[model samples]
Every structure is written in structure tokens, then in C-alpha cells.
Target chain A: MKKYGSLIGQLVIGALIGFFGMLAVLDGDFRIDLSPYAYPGNLIILAAAAVLAVFSAYRYVSIRNLAKQDLSGEEEDAAEGRMYRHYADASLASTLAILFSLASMSLSLLTTQPLWLLIFGLVLIAFSFIISGILPGLMKNMYPERDLPSITDKKYAEKLLNVSDDGEKHIMLGGLYKTHITMNSLLLGAIVLLLFYSIASDSSQLFSIFIIVGILAITNTQYQFSIRNK
Target chain B: MKTRLKELRARLGINQTELAKRAKISRQTVSLIERGEFMPSLLIATKIARVFKEPVEEIFQFEEEELK
Candidate 1:
């Protein structure tokens, strides 16, 4: 059943792309007047996109299973956990879109074939991942994946931490909430920049940001947050 | 990062269950807090302080010198 389901999904994806590719060719945009493989680049990307969609979806389910099993009783709010998981999935999808776009761009530039159609197709697929996969997935999550718990009710958390006095409680709470906001806002800011770059027709800018985001994620989560908590 | 929660509880002569009931947190959370493996949130810290009849500052303190 699973096999057939995946097969059907891939077929549908291919058919849709094939139809679009044929339409583009029929409209006559081929620079070299050869449309036999005018959209081979597109076809390849569509196929790759199908595979990635299925793979990421499968991994998401697996991750969800792991989270549930590991935090069986630990999940104080199931909905909140699910929300954060969704955000993580959205972030993952955006990441995949950027990667695939880069791949198609490389193939187009490296080969003698003018893959304008392929470029068009890759852009469409990237948009699909970003809109359908990323946005929807994140809508279900309360927090983005890279952020910490953000000091839920810093006062309560402080109280738990043995912080006394009304004055200090306010500070701890403010600090925690501020940290959460800043961290999330930064990721959001980066996402906005990348989205604008992609729209302005320059996904190349996303390459550096990805690296920067990864480094920040590691440093902030592993070292800064860890040391502070310790 | 080690905490004296267990010793403190012992000094107060309260069992884990009783302490958790007072803190309104799960027994597992209490156990985790006492072990110093997982940090408590502000609310939980306040609850712990209230249980100990002390300011949260006294109940939870940094081991090293203050940041100053």
C-alpha cells in the first residue's frame, strides 16, 4: 500500500511537470529552436523534487515518532510540541528548496545546454516546497526548531530556579522572553531576507545565510544556552 | 552545577512525593531538579523557595563567585 501510494504520488508529480513543460514548449520560448529536451532540466528537477518531498515527509513522521516516544510523559503540552515540530519541518523544507535550486543552477551553468525551462521548473519546485511544505508545516508548530523553550513564564521558571523577590522575578522573565524573541526574530529576519532574494531573482544570496544560520544554531544552542543553563 | 536539593529536603525531613505535592510539579520533575541534571524554570524555583520558606536566592545559588 505504501509502495503504491508513493508510486502514485511520483507519477502525479511527473505528469503535472510534463504538462507544464509541454505547454512552455508549445508557447515557443526555446532559444535554440530545439524543444525535444528543451525542458530536460525541468524534468530532472521535477523528478528530484518528488523524491525529496517523499523522503522529507517520511523523515518527519519518523522524527515525530521519536519525539513522542522519548518524551512520552515529558510533553507537558502536546499541541505546543506538535507546533514546534511543524515549524522545524517548515525550516527543513525551505532548506531543501534552496539546495535544489542551487543544484539546478549548477547543472544549467556547467552544461552546454541552455536550460531556461529547467530553471523555470526548478524555481517552481522551489516555490512549491517553500509554500506547500515549509509554510504549512510551520503553521502547526508553536516555536521554530532552532529556538529554546524561551523561558516559558520566566517568573515561574525563576521560581523553579529559586529566584526570589518580585523585582528579580521580573528581570528573569524579561530576559527569557527577550531571548526567545530575539532568537526567533533573527531566524525570521534571515528567512525574510532569503525570501526577498529569491523573489528578486537572486537565490545565490541564500548560500551564505544557510552557513551562517547553521553556525549560529550550533553556537547559540550548544554553547551559549548550555553554559547559561548550567 | 550540583545542587543541595536532596540534602535540603532531607534536612527538612520531607520525602520526594511530599515535596512534589507542595511544588505542584511532577515527581519526575522534582527528581530531575534534585539531580541538578535539568534546570528548573522560574515558577518552579519560586515554588521550591516557598516550600523551603526562604527566598529563591537562598534556595538556589551559583557555586562559583558571583558575576559581580
Candidate 2:
């Protein structure tokens, strides 16, 4: 849920790239060259792109399942807990998809492989815009009825206030907040490091941003594991 | 933590939604409380107890093993 903002932002960026890529394709500037570039550099780029694409697909599926699970089940708190867990997973999947699309773009730029570039760019757009942005809500719509009571109701607010004042509930809520903050900080640090590395490297600005996003995605997974194992 | 929320609610002949409304909490929160899956704050416990016209201690009991 926390990741939605960033996911939307990324989706916008990906959509923009796809929009331009589509223009290039329609203009016939992007062509499918069946003949391989046959250079070692081109080969490496293609290989990397392939790997990232595979991972992106895998992550998207994982997120879809997690989202489904988060919305289902009997226990309200347990469902909420699942939501917290899936937020990180969904963020990671979005990042991977973005990275895969970017990798394809990079490969295309390096080898003049318009097909790979356009294909991956479109995939990135779909993953970001559709998968990360709107899929969860759509999936949640499948379960139109929610058993959990709305917090906005006057009576519910009183109950919440009552529950909130209790020692154990207070402690539990506090711990969840603390953990969320810690994970955010850790992810922020990783982004900072990626920024520095990007500046030090020869990659394009877009590539650097994509790499930072990839790191941010990884941090979510790491945070989940750290909490679970601890 | 152990609670007699379900038993009390049953005795009162009220559903979770009604009790939750009266208690000023979400239906899910009330359900969770009844299931003993969530621990409420002192105020909430007292409020719930008040709704049932019983002492908080009468509705909720703490187990020593649970504390450990």
C-alpha cells in the first residue's frame, strides 16, 4: 500500500517512454532486424535483457498472488498484515519490471536493435501501468464485500480509540510502525548509494534511475526477510 | 489473553456488528476481540465491559503462561 505512490510514478515514466517508443515504431524508425549484431558487447546486453525480462515476469506473477491473498481470508488483522507484507513484494516486482524494460532499451540503443527496445519498453509500460498500478484494485474488486468494518464510521472510531489505548494493541501498533520506518530508512540509504554509484559510472541518466529503482526493490525483499527471520 | 466476548454478546442477543456499533469500534475489531486474536486497550476493554454491564476482569482474563 505504501509503495503505490512510487509505483504510480514509475508507471508514468514507463508509459512516457513507451509513448515515445511507439511513435518511433509507427514512424518506422524502429525496425526488427533479425540479423544478430554478432558482437560480444551486443551479446552480453541481449543476455542481460533476457534475464531481466524473465525475472520481471516472475516477480509480476508473485505480486498478483500476494495481492490476491492480502484481500482474501477471515482474520482482519491477518489480512492487514498480509497487505503490509505484499506492499514490499509488489514494490519489488514493479522495480524488476521497470528494470527489465530499461535493460531492453539499453540493449536496443547499444545494438540498434529496435525490436528488442520497443518490445521491452511496451512491456515495461504494461507492467508499470496495468500490473502495478491497477491490478490490485481490480483483483480486490473480485471480493466486493469486505468483512472488516470501515474505520471511518463514528462507532468504529470509538472502538479503535478504545483498542488503541490498550497496552498490548498500542505496543503492537507501535512495533509495526517502527519496523515500517526502519525499512523505509534502509531503502532510502540504498537509493542514496545507487545515486552515488550512478554518478560515478558511465550509464545514462535513465539507466542510473532504473538501477536505483532496482536496488530499492531489492531492499523491500531484504527488509521482509529480516523481519521474518528475526 | 482470553475474553468472553462471544459468550457475552450471545447472552446479550446481539450480533458483532451491533456490538461493534455500540462499542464504537469496527466490526472487524470486535470480531477480532471476540476471537481473542487481538488485545484491546484498557479503555476499549472497560468500554466493552461497560456495554455488558460487567467488570473488565470478568470479561477478560490474562493467562500467566501467555504473559511469559
Candidate 3:
């Protein structure tokens, strides 16, 4: 799935932004001083968070609708390919949703202002609900369980069995399998590092990083599971 | 590079969907194969050949330029 390049790119960008936010918080120097009493900027940040939430909801619907179109009566292999393509697209959208939430959280960390922090926290909360709850549920519906092949359908089974094990297929499958394992391991390691850092820092701000990293871990795990199962 | 898939399927009185289902592939792939837009891998070609009880050479042929 080189088709997933864009999704991976978005994820990398989000990670970079989160990294910079961590640096800003670590510096402990407040740059761009605003009136401590000024609630106007806080209100604007909150409004922006609200707008993101609405946009996320709209985008979620749009992604689902686009995926649904892939299910039109088509050849089984092409349909399967379409299903995979949909997964990639939906995942990209989900990553964006997570990024928006993380953006809010990172903003909170940078400002260290209680109101801005709270608003960003709420943004993360809303997106967590969407990404974890709604999107997975929709995916489950899109890819329902299928019955295992029986021995009685031997002819069709025989045909289906070795159709994907040719040389090129093997190379492609091996490459994807290796990529998934490597990425999953790296993401799991990152989550562990985040956990250790949060403990060492004794800071709640780092918890946001921990949460976003945890979310990424879940996404990676789910993708690997889907690839193996499908 | 070229295939007699459409002609053969017509002779068998079958549609693209039926051929795809029997071959355990997508109709889109079958259509692409017929239109010479996509070449089937060996495994798929074998499966399709089995469906027709024919040899792969009979179903698919490479043009002179393609052989080059």
C-alpha cells in the first residue's frame, strides 16, 4: 500500500508538531506575552476548537460516504482492493482528526494558560470520541465477518487458495508484513518512552503526549490486525 | 499483451461477473484483462484457464512487439 503515503505523511507532520510543542513547554520561557488577564485570545482558541470539532464531524461523514461507494457490485478482487483503498482513506481522515485534537492539546501545553489548556483538552476529548468510537464502529460495519471456506466448495477453494502466492505476490506481501511489524514495534517503543518521560517529568502536560502516542499505537495495531485477518 | 477473454467468455455464454466469480477474482480485473488494460499474474491466468478448461496460451497471447 504505497497508496497510504499521504496518510503516513500526515502522521509524521503531526508527530513533528507535537515534538515542537514539547520543546516549547520544556524551554519554560514564555514567549509572545499576552495580558494574563485577557480572555479574548482564550475565547478565540475555544472557538477554533469548536470549529475543528464541527469540521471533523463533517469530514467523518464524508469519508464514510466515500467508502460506502466502494461496495457497489463489482468484481471480488477489485472490490477487495477498493475496500483496502477505503481503509487507507478512512485512516488518513482519522489521523487528521487525531491531529486536530493533538493540536488543541499541544496549544494548551504551549500557552500554559488554564483556559486555553482546558479548551484544548476538550478538543482532544471530542476527537477521541470520534476516532475511537464512531470510526471503528463504521469500519466494523463496512468489513463484517465472513464464513470460513468449507471442504465442500473444494473447486472454488482450490482456485482461491494459490492465486495469491505467486512470486510477485510473495515479495509484495513480505514487504508489507515487514513494514507493519517494524512500524508497530517503533510506535510501541515510542509509547513506552512517552510513558517514562511523563513519569520522569512529573508533569500533566506530558500526559497529552502520552495519550496521542497511545492513540497512534492503537491505530497501528488495528491496521496490522486488519491486514493479517483480511 | 492481448487476450481472447471476451471472445472466449462469449463463447461460453457467460458474463464478466460469472467468469470473475468462478475464477475468484474481481469483475473489474476481468474487464481490465479483456480490454488489455491489465495483465493477469500467472496464478490468476492459471485460475481463469482452469475455469474454461483451456490452456493459458489459448486465452492469452503476446503480440510480436510485446514479445520483443
Candidate 4:
């Protein structure tokens, strides 16, 4: 969610992840048998990817607009939901990445060399995203809402809470919520896989441990900083 | 955390929606501040005080932390 990123940015991220997955194929990082891409049924996968890309773009625009607007009561709630939807859109990228990566793994499985290395690489992709996403929730507690730099702006700070003041940072909370949720979901899945891998080796446990620690810390913070706290 | 914001708004004859419009913040923010669902930032606290023509401390007292 950098200021300059848009649908194109997301696509770029997707392509890069996909490219690494392709590397997963060539290097035998993991292995799975893939249905050939030329098959008519595989066209569905391509179409799904296209749809995910479009949805991600729409959500990106909607949440970004929320961040910019200064709306009122009901409108603010609506905007929050829209921002959440935007984060939800990114899951499609994740889903596709999982599917395609698996396809590559399956293709590798057909060869003589086992693709154990690719599994490790896919695990890395999942680990990075989850940790990044969970970072905010834990950090949010450390960073209280009372001193946001935005609140210091003359336009937002000195003025009364006018509709216009809500403009720049209006729907930010919602957007943040979405970002965390999408990240958490992806991380959760990753952690589960890591759990399975744990029976074989200790390395897989590291990421899941971080995830659990992060979740507990964030939950504690959420309750501690809840608005209802006395 | 419940506030006298409603009373202040009524005294000024400003509807919540109108006050929200004037404040450049959402009505939910106003409501939340009043109900104590979310603490306002210092700037927002000041803004509320400004709307009521009062000091920020008067409008938003910190809750006394309970002794453990």
C-alpha cells in the first residue's frame, strides 16, 4: 500500500512471485505433476487470474479513495467495508500463487529428482507475507492512536472535526484492518503447513512460532487499547 | 470516557451531522468519542474542545489507571 502502487504494482508482485515459482520448477526446489497449460481446462485458471487482477485493482482504488475522503457517520462505515474488500482482493493473488506453485511442484514430481527444495522455497514465500502482515497488528499497539502524525496537520488538527478534515485519512482505519486481515489469513495458512512440516524438521517451526507469538501479542494489545478500556 | 459533547452540541444548536460536517470528521467519530468507543487523538480532542469553546482537558479527561 505504498502511495505510488496501484493495480500495476500488485500485478508486478504477482508476476515476480510467479517467476520465483517458475524457478522453483527449474531448480527442483519442489515437485508436483502439472496438467499441461495447453489443456482447455487450464484456460479456466487463466481466466481466474484475470478476474483476480481486476478485483484487486478495484479494491485498491476503493480503499485508496477512502484514505483520501472525509466522509460522515454511515459513509465512514461503508468506506471501511470497501477498504476491507480491497484487502480481501489480494487473497486472490495469494490463492493463484498457491495453485500455480503447486502446479509447478507437480510437474517437478514427474521427474526423477525430488523437488524438496521447491517446497522450502514456497514455504519462504508464505513466511515472508505472514510475518509482514502480522507485524502491523503488534506494532499498532506500540503506536497509540493518540499521536498520529496526521492528527498534527493544521488542516486536520487545528480545525474542528469537519467533513473536510476527515478527507485525507478518513477511511485509513478500515484500510489498515483489511491489510492486516489479508495478511493474517495468508500467514495462518502458511503456519498450518509449517506445522505439518515440523514433524520432519525444526526449521518449519520457526515461522509458525513467530505467527503464534505475534497473534498473542496483538490480541493482548487489542484488548488493552480497546476504546472501552477505562 | 462518556463525554458532554452531546450537551455541548445541543447548546450550540448544532445537529450531530452538522457538527460532523463542520469538523471534517465522520459522525461516527463524534459518536465514538462521546460513547468512549475510541479515544480521540490529541488534535481531535482539541478540535472537540474548539467546537464546544472549551479547553481540551475539560472535554477529555484521562481515565485514572486502576492500581493493580
Candidate 5:
């Protein structure tokens, strides 16, 4: 229970946000206007992107330096492990920055925004793409002995899993199992909420509900098939 | 299962990464084994035993209830 406390809290918060968002959409007067705040918002987003980029660069350089150094001592080996963790964190931050910037660019495109906003969004998107692209290569530098595949490779997932040790596989299995259970539960809850919304608003949620159910069926079937013979 | 992995590594004057490299496993696995968070396979146990020049039984011990 204690282990799942934060997950449960996040789920509740997400559900509440979704509920309010749906309510706003159904109110019939909901409108999103970002023209007024576009300049300042984009500037803030650019600043955030710059900060993340700098942090990722710092981690990359640090890992590179550590990897090149004589890691023969116990302390040096421990430092290498720390670098790996820092690299993972930095990679996650870079991905988040990319996603956030992309979302902001989409908003700019959707709303009545200025030309300069669009250009800024494009530059930010390009910068994000470059950062995300370089991260995997930085990770590879830390493990020069292993032949790590690029993210764009067709067999990257299989190759990566093959390279993982049993303990890492065990951890991955536990995480994936939890994610599967959570996804199924969340999809079921979403169906229930859609049903209520449809009934209350006198609007058909059949399409959305069918899509959700279809996704659930497909994923469950895939999981079952993958392990049925095992 | 409890393991004297840390103790053995210390005796060998090696860190987790060195042990992992010698045992042909991940450093994370070495750490997990030390923390008693994971029960290693016979292959891994043997490998680790080889690294520390000890028997598997000497490195990993099972409690009475765990045996049951």
C-alpha cells in the first residue's frame, strides 16, 4: 500500500483534471485563446528548453570525461554508476523538454498567434529534436564495450533487452506488469466516465468508448499471446 | 534469500562494478544481490561464486521459512 500511495495520488489528480476538462468542454462556451500570452509563454518555454539543454550537455560532458578517465579504483567504479544514473535522469528531462516544447508549438499553431511565435516554436522544436537524438549516442559512450543500437533501429527493443542482465530483466518485468494492470484499470474507469458523460450531456460517447475498448482488447490479447506458450 | 555479496566483495577488495564485470553481470544486479532485493539464478550464483572464489551456498543463505 505504501509503495502505491504516490501512484494512487497521481491517478486521482489526473482523474480530477480530466473530469474538469470534460466539464469545461461540455459547457458550450469554453474557448482557448493564447494570443495575449503567446509572447511571454513562448519566452518562458524557450528559457526552460535552454536550461534543460544546458543540463543535458553538462551531464553528457561529465559522463564522457568519466568514461575516458582511468576507472580502475573502487571509488571510480562507483562514480561510473552515479554517472549512469545521472545520464538516465538527464535523458528523461530532455525527452520531457521535447514534448513540452512540441505541445507549445501545437498550441501556437492552433491559436491566432503571431508569425514570430511560429518561428520561435519551430526553432525550439528543432533544438529539442537535436537534443533527443544525441542522448542515445551519449549513453553508448558510457558503455563502449557493448554494441548499443540506435533508437531508430528496427530491432532496438529486442537488442536492448538482450543486452540487459537477469536482474535488470527482473526489474523491467515487475515494472511492465504493474503498467499493464494500471492501464487496464484506467481504461475501464475511463469507459465508466464516458458512459456517465454521454448520459448526462445527452451526447453519444460510443465512438470514444469503442476505441478505448478496442485498445484494451488488443493490448490484453497481445500480452496473452506473448506469454501463452511460455 | 540473504547474500554476503557485499562482505565477499569487500574481502576481495573489489567494488560492485568490478564484481559485476568479473561475474559477467550488471552492476545493478550486484547491488540488488547485496541488498537482498533479488534472488539470482544458479548460473549467476555460480558466476558470482567463481568471482569471489567461494561456494554458492557460502555466499547465499536461505532462512528456515524460505526453505519451506
Candidate 6:
């Protein structure tokens, strides 16, 4: 019970959010309008992008320095562990920064906001792309003994997976299995909600429902095919 | 399965990262094995055993229910 306390809390919160979202979808009068708050929202998004950019840069530099250092004793081993964690953090932060910047740009274009905001978004997108490109190189630095393939390599994913040890593969298997199950369940729930919304509201969500079902079928088929021979 | 990995590493004056390197696995995997959250595969078990110069059963011990 104690072990599942947090999971139960999250499920309850998710249920509440889903209920409210369904209510809003069903209520004809409830419409979402972002026009009024477009400028303020874009500003907040820009702030977030800037913060993430700075954090990713800091992490990148820290990891680079840690990788280059030749420490002895327990510190070397500790540094190795820290370097891996910092690399993951930097990768995530840079990816989020790119996404947030892209969102800001799209919002600005749709709202016909100021040119400066769009320019900032473009600059951020370029910066994040560069950071993303350099991250795989940093991984090579950390594991100089291993012949890690470049990100641009055609078979990078296969090569990378092949390089992983059995334990790492086991962990990936567990995580991917959980993700597959969760995604299927969530997409089914989404399809049900779309069905209800289409029946109750003026807008027909038939296309969206079709797309979700297609996705579900394709993903399940892909999983089955991947494991069929294995 | 519970492992004597942490005990062996302590005796050898090595950290998780070093043990992982010696075993050709990730440090997180070593940490998980020590915490009994993850059970290593046969190959990984043999690798870890080689690193510690011990037999696989001597390092990893499982109860009857776990075996079932």
C-alpha cells in the first residue's frame, strides 16, 4: 500500500483532470480562447526557453570538463556516474528548449505578434539544435574506450543498442514494455472520450478517432511483429 | 535475487562505476543489482563473477520462492 501511495495519488489526480476535461468538451459554451493572453503566454514561454537553454549549456560544460579530468580514487568513479546523469539532463533540457521555442514561434506566427519574438525563437531553435548535435560527441568522450557511432550514422540506433550491455538492455526492455502498455491504455481512453465528445458536441471527431485507432493498431502490430520471431 | 556485489566491491575498495566498468555494464545496473531491484542475466552474472573472481552462485543467492 505504501509503495503504491504515490501511484494512487497520481491516478486520482489524472481522473479528476480527465473528468473536468470531459465536462469542458461536453459543454457547448466552454471554448478555449488564447487570443487575449497570447502575448503574456509567449513571454512566459520565452522565459522558460531561455532558462532551459542556460541550464543545458551549464550541464554541457560541466560534463565536458568532468569527462576531460583525470581524477583518481573514488572521485573518478563518482565523476563517471555524475557525467552520465549530467549528459542525460543536458540532452533532455536541450530537447525541451527546442520544443518550447518552436511552440513560441508557432504562437507568435498564428497571433501575428512582434517580429522580435519570432527572431528570438529562431535563434533559440538554432542554439538548441547545435547543442543536440554535440551531445552524442560528449557521450563518446565519456566512453572513449567504446566505439560509439556518430548521431549522423544511418544505423546509429541499431549500433547503439548493440553496444549496450545485457543489463542495460534489460532495463530498456522493462521501460519500453511499460511504455507500450501505458500508451495503449491511454489511447483507448482517448478514443472513448472522442466518441463521447463527437456524439454530444457539434464537431465530429471521427477523423481524430480514426487516427488514434490507426495508431493503436499500427503500434500493436509493430510490437507483435518485432517479437514474433524472437 | 540478493547479491553480494556491494560487499565484494567494498572488500575490493572499488565503487559501483568501477565495478560496472570491470563487468562491462552500466553503473546504474550495478546499483540496481546491489539494491535487489534487478536480477542480472546469465552473461552479466558471469561477467560480474569474473570481475570479483567468484562463482555466480556465491555472488547471487535466490530464495526458493524467487526461483519458482
Residue lDDT tens for model 3, A10-117: 889978976776775566544333446335555564555556555556655665664456332334435545554555555555555455556556556666566746
Full ranking by lDDT: 6, 5, 3, 2, 1, 4
The best candidate by TM-score is 6
lDDT of 1 at A13: 95
What's the ranking of the predictions by TM-score, best on top?
Answer: 6, 5, 3, 2, 4, 1
Q: Which portions of model 4 show Cα errors greater than 4 Å?
A: A1-47, A52-230, B10-21, B24-32, B61-68
Fnat computed for model 3 = 0.04
Q: Which candidate wins on DockQ?
A: 5
iRMSD (Å), candidate 6: 2.1
lDDT of 2 by residue, A1-230 (tens): 76999999988996697567545544553333333653444445445545554554555565455446543223434554344445455555556666655655665655655475567566555655454554344323322343333434557535544544243364457777897788677766565545444344423355656766777678678878978998
Which consecutive 10 residues in model 6 chain B have the weakest lDDT in total?
Answer: B17-26
| Model 6, span B1-68: residue lDDT tens | 77898789989988887787787787778877887788888989999999989999999998999889
What does candidate 1's lDDT look like per residue over A106-147, in tens digits? Answer: 556655556664565466566646454434333223223222
For every model shown, what is its TM-score relative to the native structure?
0.32, 0.37, 0.42, 0.35, 0.75, 0.80
Of the two candidates 2 and 3, the one with more favorable TM-score, higher being better, is 3
Which should have the higher DockQ, number 3 or number 4?
A: 3
Between candidates 1 and 5, the one scoring higher on lDDT is 5
lDDT of 4 by residue, B1-68 (tens): 54778778778877655666566565557766766676777777777787778987777765667222
Fraction of native Cα contacts reproduced by each candidate? 0.00, 0.14, 0.04, 0.04, 0.64, 0.50
1 or 2, which is superior by lDDT? Answer: 2
Better of 1 and 6 by lDDT: 6
Q: Quality of candidate 3's docking, in CAPRI categories?
A: incorrect
Q: What DockQ does each listed candidate score?
A: 0.06, 0.14, 0.22, 0.09, 0.66, 0.50
lDDT for each residue of candidate 5 in A106-170, tens digit (9 for 90 to 100): 76787766777667667766766777677777757676655677878888779889888899899
Chain B structural similarity as TM-score, candidate 2: 0.88
lDDT of 6 at B55: 97
Q: List the residue pairs that clash in candidate 2.
A: A155-B24, A156-B25, A159-B24, A159-B25, A166-B41, A166-B42
| Candidate 6 chain A weakest ten by summed lDDT | A25-34
